[model samples]
Target chain A: MFEIFGIPSNALFGQLLIGLINGSFYALLSLGLAVIFGMLNIINFSHGAQYMMGAFAAYLMLKYSGLGYWPALIIAPLLVGITGVIVERLFLQWLYKLDHLYGLLLTFGLALIIEGVARNQLGSAGLPYVVPDELRGGQNLGFMFLPNYRAWVIVASLTICIATWFIIERTRLGAYLRAATENPALVRAFGINVPRIITLTYGFGVALAAFAGVMAAPIYNVSPQMGSELIIVVFAVVVIGGMGSILGAIVTGFGLGVVEGLTKVFFPEASNTVIFVIMAIVLLVRPAGLFGRRA
Target chain B: MEQRVAEPIATPEVQPTVWRTQSATILFVVMVVGLIVAPFFTYPLFLMQAMCFALFACAFNLLIGYVGLLSFGHALYFGWASYLSAYSAKAWGFTPELAILTGTATGAVLGLLAGSLAIRRQGIYFAMITLALAQMMFFFALQAKFTGGEDGIQAVPRGHLFGLIDLSKEMNMYIVVLVIFLAGFLFIYRIIHSPFGEVLKAIRENETRAISLGYKTDRYKLVAFVLSATLAGAAGGTKAIVLQLASLTDVNWPMSGEVVLMTLVGGLGTIFGPVLGSFIILVMQYKLAAVGEWVLVIQGVIFVACVLLFRRGIVGELANKLKIRL
Candidate 1:
C-alpha cells in the first residue's frame, strides 16, 4: 500500500533484506581477510575458494555421511581450517621472506587449483543445499514476508563477526596477535611461540571464511566457480575499508552490500559496477582507505 | 649484510659482458629466422595466437620487470582495444591498420586515467586498484550494447591493411601479426636500454632514493604504464583481426591473471621471459585441451612452484645460474 518515489515498499524492503544478507557475507569474508593480512601480510586470494570449500564440505557431509545442517556447520569449518593450516605450513611459509606480491600470486594459484579440482570432480552447475525444516518457513511482517532461514543467516553472520571482533579487540590472545603483528621479532624475544600463533591465526581466518561459506550454501548455488566470482568484490571491500581495522571491514562490507542492493532498485545496470566505481572515488579521495593507516 | 653489499658491486661488472655475448646474438638471429619460417610448417592461426599473447605478456612485463609495479588489470586495455578495433573494422568499415591504431589510442587514454588513479597507491594496493578499475570496465563491457554483451563482437572483419594488402588470407594475417609483435618487442627492448629506462629501473629498485635524487618518479611510472597499456591494446587489436572476434574472455579478470601467470612462468624481469612463458602456457593449454578443467589446476601448480621454488623463472634462473643474459 505504501510507496516511496513511486516504488512499492515491499519490493524496496525485499531488496534491502537481500542486500543485508549479501553484506553479511561480505563482512564475514573481509573480516577474515583483514585478520589474515594482519599477521601474514599476505592477501589470501583463496579466501573465496576456501569459502566454496566450506560449502562443499557441508555438501559432502550431507551427501555421503547423511549428517544434517547443524553438525555440518560445526564440522565443515574445522575441516576447511585444517586444510588452511596445511596450506600455510607447506606453501605460504616460504613466501613470508619475499615480496608481498608473491603471497598474492601463490594464493591465486592455490585458488585455481582448488576451484579447478572441484570443477573437475563436480561439474559447474550449482548444486542446491536444502534449507533445513526448522528454518524453512517464512513470517508475514505486514510490509514483507521474512524467511526464517534468511534471518538466521543475517543473525549468525553478525554474531560471528562480533564474536571475532571481541576476540581480537578485547581478549588476551588478541593482545598477543596485535603485539606480534606489530613486531614479530620482539614478540619472539618475549618467549611467545610466534610461528605457531601465525599458523593458528591463518587457520582461524580461513575458518571464518569457511563459516561464511556454510552460511552461503543454502542461499546461493554450491558451485566450484562461486568463490572466484565473489572474491573480487570482497577485495574491493578490503580496499575501500582499508584493511587497517577489523571493524572497518565489517562496516564497509555490510554498507556496500546495502548500497549494491539499493543500486538494483534505482539503476539496475550499474549494480554490478557500483562498488568498483565507488572504489575509484575512494582511492581518489582517500587512497589510504577509510580505515587504513598510510602505507 | 656483506653478501648483500657485494651483490650491487658484482652486478654492474657482469652486466655489459653478458649483454654483448656471442651466444646472445646468435640466439636473437635464430629466433627471428624461426619466426619468419615457422608459419610454413605450423598452423598460422595457432602461431598468430601465440604471437599476440606473447606481445601482450611482454607489454605486461615492461611494468612489472622494469618499473617494479605489478598491474593486475591489464585486461582492460587489451580487451577494450580488441572491442574497439573489432567495432571500428566491422561496424565503421575501417582498415585493419587504422582500427588497430584506434584501439592502441584508446588503450593509451585509458592507461592515462587508470594509471593516474592507481599509482597513488604502492605495491599491493596498486595491484588491487588496477584490478578493481578493470572490473569496472568489464561490467561496462558486459552492459554496453556496442560490445554485443555476452556474445561479444563476433566475426570481426579482417579488413585490408592500409587499404592495400588483403588481410583475410591466413598468410597475410600471420605476417601482419608477426610484424606487430616484432615492432612491439623491439620497441620494448629499445626502451629498456634507453636512459629513460635506466631511470625507471632506478625507481623500481628504490623509489624513495630515485625521488630524492631529483627524478620525477611518478611521471616516469605513469609514462611507462601508458606505454605498456598501449602496446597491450595493440596486441589485443591485432588478435581481434586474426580471430575475427573480440569477446568478454579478453577483458575478464581471468585473462588478467593469465597474463600475470605467463610473466611469472617465463620470468618476471627478464626481456624474453614473457615470450617463452606464453609459448609454454599456450602449448600446455593446447596439449591439455582434452583434460578439461585440469589445465587450471596445472597452471595453479606451476604458480605455486614458481613462487616457492622457481621464483627466478625459467629464463631468469638460467640467466642467473649460467652467467648469461637471456
Candidate 2:
C-alpha cells in the first residue's frame, strides 16, 4: 500500500521535507540570535522584524530595481544589515549599561514599530514572491517530489550556518568576538575597537535573519505578520538548544523540525504546540538548556 | 550573555509621620471620589473598561516592580480565565461571582505551573520561558472546543450577582466592577507594603543576598507570581462579564505587550501608577480605534520613549520631583 504508520509514503516524506525547510530557517535565525546575544548582551527582539524586512527588501528591489532573486538575495541582507547598524548605533547603544530586560523591551518596541509600519503600508495580507527561474522545478525522488527552491533553501541555509560556525569557532575575528563577549574591558585594553565590533556583530546577526527571510519568501508568503509567530518558534528552539554553542543551535533546530514533522503526521493537533511542550519539559529538567553552560 | 540585574526601587524607608498619614488618606479619598464621579461625565463603559485594565496592569506591576521578573506572557492567565469564566457563566449557568472565582482560580493554578518552570532561570530567560509557555496555552485555546475557535466564547450572560441583584442593569454591573477593582487595588497595596513585600524588594535588590539571608527566595517569588496571576485573572473575568464576550485579543502576545506598556507608562513600582497608566492607554486606544495599526505604532513610540528618556515613568518622575512616593 506504500503506507508507513497508516500514512502514505509521499505524504510522510513531503511533511518531513517541509519540516526540514522550516528547521533550516530556525537554525539560521537562532544562530544569528546567539551570535548577537554573545556580543551585544542584548537579545535583539527586533530580529523577527529584521527577517520580515529582508523579505520586504527583496520585494521592493524586484518591484523598482527589477532585481532577480540572486541579486536581491545579496543586496537585501546588506540593506537590512545597514538598518541593524543604525538601530545598534542609536537606541541599542544607550541600553548597554541598563538591565538586560530593558534591551528586550526596547527591541520589542522596535519590533512593534517595524511590524506596525509594515502593516500600515502593506495592509496585513501576504504578497507572493516568485521562486527564482533557475530553481522553479521539482525532482521526483522515488518516495516523494521535492521542489528545487525548497531544497535550495535547505542547502543554502545549512551552508551559511556551517560557514558562520566555522567563522566563529575557527577564525581570529570570532576569537575576538568570544573574548569581547566575556570581557569588554579586556578586549578594549587590547586596543581592538570593541564598539565597532559590537556594532558589526549586531549587523551581521541581523543580516543572517534577513538572509533567512529572503530564502523563506518563496516557500512562505512575504507578509508583515510572517515573522511574528515564526520568531516565537525560534525562541523555543533557542531555549531547547541553550543558545550557547553554534552547533547546538543548528542541531536542535533541525532535530526539533523533524520531531514536529513526525508530530504532524501522528498527532496533527499538537503540531502547533509540540515544541513548547518539549520546552516545558526541558526547562523543568535542565533549565540551562541542552548546550548552555550550567550556572 | 551578560547577566545584569534590573535597577533597584529607590525606597527610602518611608517613615510613617502623622502628616504623611493625613495626606495619604486625603489623596486616597479624593482618588476614590474622582473615580466614582468621573463615570457620569464620560462614557460609563469606557471607565469600566479602564478599571478592568487598571487591575490587570497593577497585577502585572507586582512582579516586574517588586521581584524584577518581567513576564511577557501574562495574557495566558487573563484570557484563559476569561474563557473558563465565560464558559461557566453562559453554558454551566453559574453565578457571576462563581464564574469570576473560577477564572481567578484558573490563573493561580497556571501561575504555579508556569512559575515553577520559569523561576528556574533568572532575568531574560524567565521572560522567554513565560512567553513560550503562554504561546503554548494560546495554541491550546485556539484549537480547543470550548474556546469557539477564534470567534471565541461570545454573548456570555453576566447573570446575577449572588442570585439577587440583576447584573443586566448597567449601574449595578458598574458598581460591582468598581467595588471589585477597589478591593483588588487595595489588596495589592497591602501586599506591596507588607513584610513579605519587603523581602520581595530585597530580592529585587540582590537575590543572592536574600538567599544568603536564609530566606527561600524562590518560594517568595512563586507566591508573588501566583498572586499577580490571580489578580490579572480576576480582572479578565470581570472584563469578560462586562463585555459579554471572551476573544483571542485577551490571550494574544499583543495583549501582553499592552499590559506591559500600561504598567510602564504609569509607574513600575508605584501603587497608583498602573491605574493611571491604564486610563491613559485605554483612552488612547479608544481614540485611535479608527486608525488601526497606527495605534501599535504609537504604543511602540511610547514604549521607546519610556525606556529611553522617561525610565521613571509619569508617576515615578512626579514622585521624584515632589520628593514623595505615590
Candidate 3:
C-alpha cells in the first residue's frame, strides 16, 4: 500500500534487484574482456557464445548426468575453458599477426558455429534452471526484499571481480602476464612460455563468461539467445569503460547497471537504450572510454 | 615519335587486363540475359529476391571495400527502409517508385546519423558501435506501432510504377526490381571508380596520411556511408515490394550478418563479387530452408574458409589471378 514517488515500492525494488543482477553479469563479463584484451589483444566475440555454452552445459549436466548446480558451476566453466583453449591453439592463433578485425571475424564465425549447434539441438525456446536448495529464501530488508540467489550472485561476482583484480594487479604471475602483454619477446627470454600464457588467458576469459552463464541460468532462461543480446550491451559497456583498466571495467559495469535500473524506475521505455545513450555521450566527450588511455 | 614517349613505363599485364575486361563484359551481358530470361525457366519471385539481396550486399561492399570500415549492423538501414516503403505503399497508397524513394531517403538520413556516430572510432570499435546502434533500432522497431511487432507490416501492396505499370504482375515486378538493382549496382560502380571513391580508399588505407593530405577524411567517410545505406535501403524497399512483406527478420542482427556474409563470400573488395555471392547464398538458402541450423553452420564454415584461405573471396581471387581489378 506504501508508495515511493507515487510508485509501488515492490515494483521499484524488484526492478532494482534485476538491474543489479544484470549488472553483476556485465561486470564479470567485461572484466574478463578487459583482462583478455590486456594480454591477448583479442576482443573475444565468442564470449557470448561461450556464456551460452556454459548455461547449456549446466542444463545438460542437470538433465543428463544428474549434476547439481554446485558441481555444474565448477564443471561448466572448466569444460568451456578447455574448448576455449582448443579454439585458441587451433584456429585463433593464426590470426595474431593479422589485423585485429580478423580476430573479430574469426570469433564471430566461432560464435555462429556454437550458437547454430545449440539451436539445432535445443531449439530456440528457453529451458528452465532451478535455484539451488541452499539459496532458496528471501530476506526482507524493509526498504527492499533481497532474494538469496540474487544476493549470492552479487556477492560471488564482486568477490570474483576483486580476486581477479588482486591477482592481475598484485600477484607475481600477474607481473609476468603483464610483462608478456607489454613485450612477449622479453617474457620469452625470461624462460616464460608466452604462447601457453596467451592460450590460458583466452581460457580464463572464456571461463569467466561461463561462470557468468552458470550464474545467469537460474535468474534468466537457459536459452541459445541468452548471451547474444547481453554481449552487445557488454561491448557498449567496454566502450564506455574502456578496455584499458580492469578496475575500470568492474566499476563501469556495476555503475551502468545501477543507472539502467534507475531508468527502469523513472522512464521504462528508455531502459533498454540507456546504456547505448550513455555510450554515445561518452563517445562525444571521451572517445577512448572512461578508463581507457588514448591509443 | 622516337623523340616522344620519354621512356614508356614497363607494364607486364596488358594481356590479362584485356582478357579480364572482355570476360567481365561477357559476364555482365550474360547476367542481364539470364535475369531477363530467368522467369521462363524459374520462378520470377525467386530471382527478384536474389537481386534484392545482391544489391544489399553490393551496398554493403561499398563501405567495407572502398571506405575500409566494416559495419556489423547494416540491417538497421535496410530493415527500416523496408518498413517505411511497405508502410507508404500499403497505408498511404503511394506508387511503388515513390515508396522506394522514400525508403532510400530514410536510409540515407539514418546512415548519415549512424555514420557520423560510428566513424568516431576506428577499426573494430567502429564495427561494434554500428552494431550497438542497430540493436537500438531493432528494439525500437519491436516496440514501434508501424512495424507491427512480430507479425511485421504484412500484405504490403506492390503498387503501380508511376501509375502506369502495374506491379501486381510477377514479370512486371521482376523487371522493376531488376532495373532498380542494376541501377543501384551501376551507381556503386561509378562511385567506386570516381575520384571520391579514391579518397575513400585512401582514408581506409591510411586515415592519418589522408588527413595530412589536406582532405577531411571524415566528410568523405560520412558521404560513403550515406551512399551505401541509401543503396541498401533501395534494395530493402525493392525486396518489400517483391515479397509483399517486411518483417523483423529483415532488420535483425542476423540479417546484418547475412549481408556481411554475402559480401565476404562474394569478395570483400571486388566490384561484382557480392552479386555472385548473393546469388549463391540465396540459391543455397532456398534449397536448404528445410535443413534448419545447418545452413548457419555451412555459412560460418564459408566465413572461416574465406577469411583463412580465400581472403580475396571468389571474385576478388579471380580478379587477382586475371591481373585486372573487378
Best by TM-score: 2
Tens-digit per-residue lDDT, B1-326, candidate 3: 01110111133366655556577667778888988888899988888999999999999999988777888999999999999999999999999999999899889999999999888887778888998889889989998999999999999989789899988998889888889988998899899889998898777677788999999998998999999999999998888888989999998988998998888888887778899999998999988899988888878887778777776788877776666666
The better candidate by lDDT, 1 or 3, is 1
Misplaced by over 4 Å in model 1 are B1-24
Clashes of each: 0, 0, 0
In the range B1-326, model 2's lDDT, one tens digit per residue, is: 33323343455457867654465456678889998998789988888899999999999999998788999999999999999999999999999999999999999999889988989888877888888899999999999999998899999998999999999988899999999999999999899889999999888888888999999999999999999999999999999999999999899898999999999988887777889999999999999999999998899889989999987788877766655667
Q: What's the iRMSD of model 3?
A: 10.4
Clashes of 3: 0
lDDT for model 3, please.
0.88
Residue B193 of candidate 1: its Cα lDDT? 89
Which scores higher on lDDT, 2 or 3?
2
DockQ of each: 0.60, 0.65, 0.43
lDDT of 1 by residue, B1-326 (tens): 01010012113235555444655566667778998999889888998999999999999999998888889999999999999999999999989999999889888999999999999888888888898899899999998999999999999989788898998898888888988998999999899989999998888777888999999999999999999999999989988889999999999999999999999998887888899899889989999999999999999999999888887788887777766666
* Candidate 2 lDDT: 0.89
Worst 10 residues of 3 chain A by lDDT: A95-104
lDDT of each: 0.90, 0.89, 0.88
